[model samples]
Each structure stands twice: as structure tokens, then as C-alpha cells.
Target: MDKIFESIEEWMRNLLTGMVSSNLTNMFTDVNEKTGDIASQVGQTPQGWSGSIFSLIQNLSDSVIVPIAGMIITFVLCYELISMLTEKNNMHDIDTWMFFKYFFKMWVAVWFVSNAFTITMAIFDVGQNVVNRAAGVINQQTAINIDSVVTSMETAMESMEVGELIILALETLLASLCLKVISVFITVILYGRMIEIYLYSSIGAIPFATMSNREWGQIGSNYLRGLFALAFQGFFIMVCVGIYSVLVANIQVSDNVHTALLSVMAYTVILCFSLMKTANFSKSIFNAH
Candidate 1:
């Protein structure tokens, strides 16, 4: 029984050591991958189910929204033209320059609607470049070290029991699952937000066509504002991940076995909770509500 307890204690120490390393590695790796995904998704459409959705939204925009926009533009311009002429007594008293002014406004409005997509993408292109450069500079370039954890618990592990080992195993499994779930949840939000950006951008020309009107123009303005918000949201997420990694790396585990375990358990809970808060935190940072 003495030998068995000794083995169990040693195994538990190893298990706990492995858990700390794995969690840190997985967390940072996920952060790196997500930043890459967010950067690449800018200005570039996706493939697979997301691609299919983009295609449908784009087709509807081109086929319905754009044509309707063109018709609306024509109607609005004609009304403006006739109104201008009538307001000046059917051009009898018209300032010849007013004709040129009306024509110029028409030209500018048409040009804006025609190139709304290119313009919106330009915003993302600049954002992506900034994010890629910043993220390259900020990262957890190496795994976290919890040598203190093992050093402190080294002697105490010699008397660990089988029941304690079982609990340790269960804790490891739960921690791993929690990390994976957080990674998946965050990845989905980043990708889904990307898809939504494209979908909203598809009909961008519609609201843009009516941009001279305050009420109608709000749609296009809000779309661009929202795009900028989502774009910067990724940067804030990078900040969160980087901050979390630094904090985890600095954790000071005490020399007592129970104390070390308590510290690790608390850290795991805090890390998971912090990661889960990142979406809302990032959103708030960028005023992305």
C-alpha cells in the first residue's frame, strides 16, 4: 500500500504538470490561428458553406437590390431635375450653373453606388494590414512554465492515493474540454462575423444610392460603421489573448501541494472565464455594440 500511494502521488504530479503546459499551449495556439483567419478573411470571400451563403446574398443583391437602386436613382434624379427646373420657373430664370451643379451631384451619387463594394473592402484591407502587423508583434511565443508547481509538490506527491489520482484525471479531462470549447466558440464568432460583413456589404449599393438623404443614408453609414467595428474587434481579441498569456506565465504557485493545486484550479477557472468574456470585451472596446 505504501508503494502504491507513492506511485499515485508521482503520477498526479506529472498529470498536473502536463495539464498546465497543455492549457497554455492550446490557448495561445488558438489565438494565433484565429488572428490569421480574421486577417485573411478581410476583402476575400470564403469557401464551402460560407461561400455558398455569400454567393446567394451577392446574387440577390446584384439581381434585385442593385437594379432597384438604379431605378430609384433614376426616379430621384428626374424628380430633382424637374424640381430644380420648376423651382426656377422651368429654366426661364434658371442659373445655368445650377444645371451643372445638379448634373455633378447625379454623377457623384451614381459613382458612389457603383463602387460601394470596392470602397468598403478598402476599409477592411487597411484594417487587416494593421492587425497582421500588430499581432505579429504580440504573442505567447513560448509555452508557459509552472516549474514551481512541480517543485513544490514534488515531495508531497509521494503519499498520494489512488482516489486522488482518479480525481486528478477527471480534472485534466474537464480542463482540456473547457479549453477546446472556448477555442471553438471564439472561432465560430470570428468567422460568422466575417460572413455577416460580406452579406451586409452585398446590398451596400442600395442604401448608398440614396446617400444624399439623411434617413436613407443611415443604412449605408451604419453598415460602414458596423464594418469598422467588427474589423477592430479582432485587434481587441488579440490584446485579450496576449494579456491573458502574460498573466498566466507570471502565476506564482506556492510550495504546498494543496496550495499549488488550488492555485492551478483557480487559474484554470479564471483563464476559461476570461477567454469567454473576450468577445464581449472586444466588442465593447471597439464600440461594436
Candidate 2:
């Protein structure tokens, strides 16, 4: 009877141990995959990230928005020319240089409207370059050392009673489920940012048309600042991931398996929160409304 009881206990222990190990393994895998993905996604320019969508947006912008921008540019230049002529002396003090200035401003306004897409893309290219450099620094360091986790976790599980191991197994399973939800949130942030970039780029010419007018230039200027904010928002996300990686790297799973797992989950939550805020933070810095 004692032999039978001992055998049953051993079987339960093994089952629970396997369950905990499997859960931990899956959780770590999710974290590492997300970390790697953020590095690559954040570094991609809009055109490089989704070429088909970007090409479609460009086509739409050229066909639809550019003509509207042309009319806006003409109206703004006419207003600007009138403003320039009248602002000096109500009509009597027109300098010869004023006409030259009006013509120069007209040329600039037309050029900006014509090449709005090019200018908008250039902003993202600069952001991509910055993020790529940061990515190289963080890519190798972000993966969780799951081997270390497995080694120490196995030894710790051996000393745990069957009932305790069962509870821990359930806990780890719950943690893993939480991680799956977090992963979805991360995916949303990445895809949503790309979609926003495409949307903003589509009407880029309209804002560029307003840039050369002294009275109305704030419209285009704020739009440009918003683009910069969107671009650098990716860089801020990379920084958040890099910080999370460093924090996770310092976690000594050998010290306490339960604490380490919970800490990892907590840090991942923090990472998601930080990534969500990057857009607003970047916009505030750029003063983009």
C-alpha cells in the first residue's frame, strides 16, 4: 500500500512539473518573439514596411489630392501676393523687390505641392535610419535566456510538493494566457502606427500647399511637425523595448522562479503601456496638434 501511494505521488509530481515547464517555455517564447518583431518593425520606413499599401496611397495622393492642393496653392499665393502688396503702405509704398518676392514665393509653393510625397517620405527615412541604429544595439540583447530559466526551474520543482507544483503550474498557465493578450496589443500598436502613416501621407500635398503662405503657413508647419512626431514615435518605441530588455536581462531566474516569472510578466505589461504612450509623448515634444 505504501509503495502504491508513493508511486501515485511521483506520477502527480512529474505531471505538474511538466505542465509548469511547458507554460514557462511558451511564455518566454512569446516575449522573445515580440521583442524581435518590435526591433524590425519600428525600424522600417512606411514604404519599406508595406510597399503595396504605400504605392496605393501614393497613387491616390497624386490623382486626387494633388489637384486639390494645386487649387489651394493658387488661392494661397494670390492671397499672399495681395497681402504683400498691401501690408507695406496700403498701396503707395510697393518696393520693386516685393514683386520678385511674390514670384519667388509662388515658385516655392508650386514646387512644394508637386513634391509633397517626396518630402513626407524623407522625414520617415530619417526616422528609419535612427531606429535602425538603435535596433542593432538592442536586437541581440532582447531574447530571454530561457535555457537558464529551464535549468534553475527544474531544480526548484524537484523540491516542491505535488500540490504546490500543481498550483504553480496553474499560475504559469494563467501567466502564459496573459502574455498572449499582451502580444496582441503589441501587434495592434505596430499595425496601427503603419496605417496612420499611410493615412497621413495620402493628403500630404494639401498641407504642403499651405506651407509657403505667411498667414496660413501654420497649417502646413503643424502638419510637418506631426509627421516628424509619427516618425520619431517608432524610435521612442525602440527605446522602450531596449529598456525592457535590459530590465529582463538583469532578472536572475535562478534566485526565485516564481518571482522571476511574475517580474517578466509585469515588465512586459510596462513595455506595452510605454509603447502606447510613445505617440503622445513624441507629439508633445514636437508640439504637434
Candidate 3:
């Protein structure tokens, strides 16, 4: 027992030290320069390059491991939500049992996803598609000089045709709309996962909250039902994000002004709605008979 405690202490100390080192700008610069030199040298030989590339990938994974762990925690919460929904309700509910089952399933899913390189590759592929499509549009539409376009606009009073101005406006509008839609889709997927994790962690106490396992299960079930009720609320959030995106994109405000307004509106609306749902969910979880 003493050895185990000492090991844990040593592990925590090392983790904190590594985290502090990573936050230092000098450490990052050194790592970047070293990696660059190693990569350049490896580029000269296929055998050497493979080993160096593997090391580079391992280093990158080390840096991102914490964030990946957080994502796993979020997945666990989602599983708990599902588990709560499936269990049969009884007068003497065993919420702790359900929680244990949910957590086990969550762990299995996390392990499978982590081991499945194809899943990670598919996510990156989707990101690449979005980037490629956006770049293609920008290249096609903005091939000419922006200064020339502005100069033409300046002389519009005397020489500009209405059709040419309308065409330019439409093109810009189309590009902006395409980007906004893509942004909303990405936001929904990311935030949906975040909310799932948060709610699961928040409700995770039911297992330990009661003396009897049956009472714990009832609490877990109630929490799960509340999560289901919030599904519509989540959909509403996506709609709100879409509307907010369009409003910002179409507004003729300065970039800073547009960003400030959008940020304030989006955060305020989302935060308020999230809080409301959480409160209602908590009440339902605790008071449901």
C-alpha cells in the first residue's frame, strides 16, 4: 500500500512537471527545431525516415494525450445516457448497477475507437474535404487582384454596370453562405460530444449518492430521461447556431464588430439554454418518483 501511494505521488509529480515544461515557449521552440532537423536528415534516406517519422508521431501523440483523454470522458457520459434509457424502471431501482454497466460499455467503446485507426483517419478525411472545398472556391473566385476590384468599385458611379456589381455580390454571398453552413455542422458535432460528456460526468454521482443500489439506479434512470428530453433542446441549439451564423455573415459590419456581436450573442444564448436544461435535468433526476 505504501509503495502504491509512493508510485502514485511520483507519477503525479512527473505529469505536472511535463505539463509545465510543455507550456514553456522555449521548450516548444526547442522541440520544433529539433524535430525539423531530424526530419530533414531523415528525408535523405527511406530507412532512417521511417524511424524518425514514427518518433515524431509518438511525440505529437504525447502532447495531445490529455485532450484525447478528455474526449474519452465525454464518450463515457454518452454511454451512461444510453444505459439509463434502456434499463427497466422499478420501485427499487438499482442506479449504481446501471452506472457500472454504462461505464463498462463506455470504456469498451473508448478502447475500440482508440485502437481503430480508420475512425481517426475518417475524421481527418472529413476535415480535409472541408478545407479543399473552401480553398477551391477561394481560388476560383478571388483569382484577380483585390486592389483592382476595389478600384473598379470606386469608378462604379461612372462606368460600373448593374449586372457586373450584382454578379460580384452574389458570388461573395454564395461563398460566405457555404462556409457558414460548414462551420455550423462542425460546431454541432463537436459541442454535441462536449455536452454529452459534461452531462454524464455531472450525473455520475447517483451511484455513490445513495446507500442502496436500487435508489442509485432510479436516479440514473431519471438523469437519462432528462437527457432524452434535452435532445430537442440540442436540436434547437443547432438551429440557433445556423441563424446566428447567417446573421453575422450577411451583416455589413466591420470584421471585429461582426465577430464581437456574434460571440456575445452565441455565448449568451447557448449558455442560458444550457443552464436552463441543466437545472431542469437536475430537478427531474433528483425529484422524479
Q: Is candidate 1 or candidate 2 better by TM-score?
A: 2
lDDT of each: 0.60, 0.88, 0.39
**Which window of ten consecutive residues has the lowest lDDT sum in model 3?**
38-47
TM-scores, all candidates, are 0.69, 0.96, 0.23
- Report model 2's TM-score to 2 decimal places: 0.96
Model 1 segments more than 4 A misplaced: 1-59, 79-93, 140-167, 253-289
lDDT of 2 at 78: 82
Clashes of each: 0, 0, 4
Candidate 2: pairs in clash: none
lDDT of 1 by residue, 1-289 (tens): 9999889777767776555445534543543454454344432433322667667766777777788889877876777777778978767898879978998989988997777766766766666666666566654352354454444434444455656645654554555566567656656756676776677667777767876544455666666666676666556655655555565455553344344344444554564466456556655655554
lDDT of 3 by residue, 110-169 (tens): 554343233232333343344344433433332323233233333332232444434434
Better of 1 and 2 by lDDT: 2
Pairs clashing within candidate 3: 93-214, 94-217, 95-216, 95-217
